[model samples]
Target: MGKEFIEIFEKWADTYDSSLTKDIEYKEVFRGYDQILDSVANKAFGEVVEFGPGTGNLTVKLLELGLSVTGIEPSPAMRKLADEKLKGKAVVKDGDFLSFTVEKKPDVFVSTYAFHHLTDKEKAEAITLYSNLLSSSGKIVFADTMFRSEEEYEKAKAAASQSGFHNLAADLAREYYSTIPKLKGMLEENGFTATFTRLNEFVWIMEGIKLQ
Candidate 1:
């Protein structure tokens, strides 16, 4: 689903980590990055299939938590960096949200900062695919940008633009970021009990546990 942004990711592979720490515009978006990764790793168990494990930041945390992780990423450049970082600790594969292969069924599907790459419809389809692939009680833990309402989203975009953060503003306008209500409804409709926690002004943690 997020394959459309592969070129951007490829170009970003080298400076991606630095951007998280030094990019003024993205500071708010990645405010609690380490904490968010920790929280996601803490909630995951058993085998994990991680979507968009760019540079293997979350993948490293998952391994540190004693969990086996398979990282699926679409950008070869990003995957290369992740492989170098992981050093063969976890399998980083080439895949995206809607297409991937796992040798065994995963107990958890985890992602961070990447889900917004998919449009709402693609997001729903991805969730449905995960729901069908997972066993009862399996989980999806994702931390990404989501607004509480469309009004807030528009306001944020406007504020960014007014603040001279045209890149950030453009990103908000270009991405398929969804509303909390829409995401929650999608999870529920797919038979998952969903919970959300606000991590920052621009990021939220969404946990969905399959009920059946």
Candidate 2:
């Protein structure tokens, strides 16, 4: 399933940005990024790392803020587009977040609409790994499809069905969506203070601050 998804993304890489602009839901998702970035606007972060940066939309924003950014992406085609878009502004690497390495520990980590590709257990492990990659005062901000509970997942599924998105609804009803409470627990247990805000019915932004 993961490989299949990567293949789909690779195929869509060239047209991803243009396609996103036409998607109303995706536009709303992009709007959530502003809030995510604003949440840490006051922080003094020297370095930032992003997971699956897609075509560098968010990477451009991070670079605009004058912070050095390293983007790790698995899809070669996607990385190519990101490379062309980011150019010298950011270092785009060919790797997944779980195994990617950097010489310098980042002051903050950012990922938008990418983490949901992992299973529940993988998500927990990823958080643990991220915790180790951060400086003592470092933080992580992410926005992705998240549900508060099983009930909310069911509600989203029903709404999707009513809107004529049968396949999408079924996918939402399955184990794809992250559970907010579980995510919070994972972050906290791994030594970060987690906070969550709903961006929309299907997306949520979360910030996790490393504990001293």
The prediction achieving the highest TM-score against the true structure is 1
lDDT of 1 by residue, 72-114 (tens): 9999998999999999999999989999999988899999999
Q: Candidate 2, residues 16-71: lDDT per residue as tens digits?
A: 77765575534544555556555544343788888888988888777778888888
The global C-alpha lDDT for each of the candidates, from Candidate 1 onward, is: 0.94, 0.77
The C-alpha stretches of model 2 lying farther than 4 A from their native spots are 1-4, 24-44, 170-175
lDDT of 1: 0.94
Model 1 clash tally? Answer: 0
How many steric overlaps does candidate 2 have? Answer: 0
Q: In candidate 1, which residue ranges exceed 4 Å CA deviation?
A: none
Cα distance off (Å), candidate 1, residue 85 = 0.5
Which stretch of 10 consecutive residues in model 2 shows the poorest summed lDDT?
Answer: 35-44
Output the TM-score of candidate 1.
0.98
Q: Clashes in each model (backbone N, CA, C under 3 Å)?
A: 0, 0
Candidate 1: residue 123 lDDT (0-100): 94
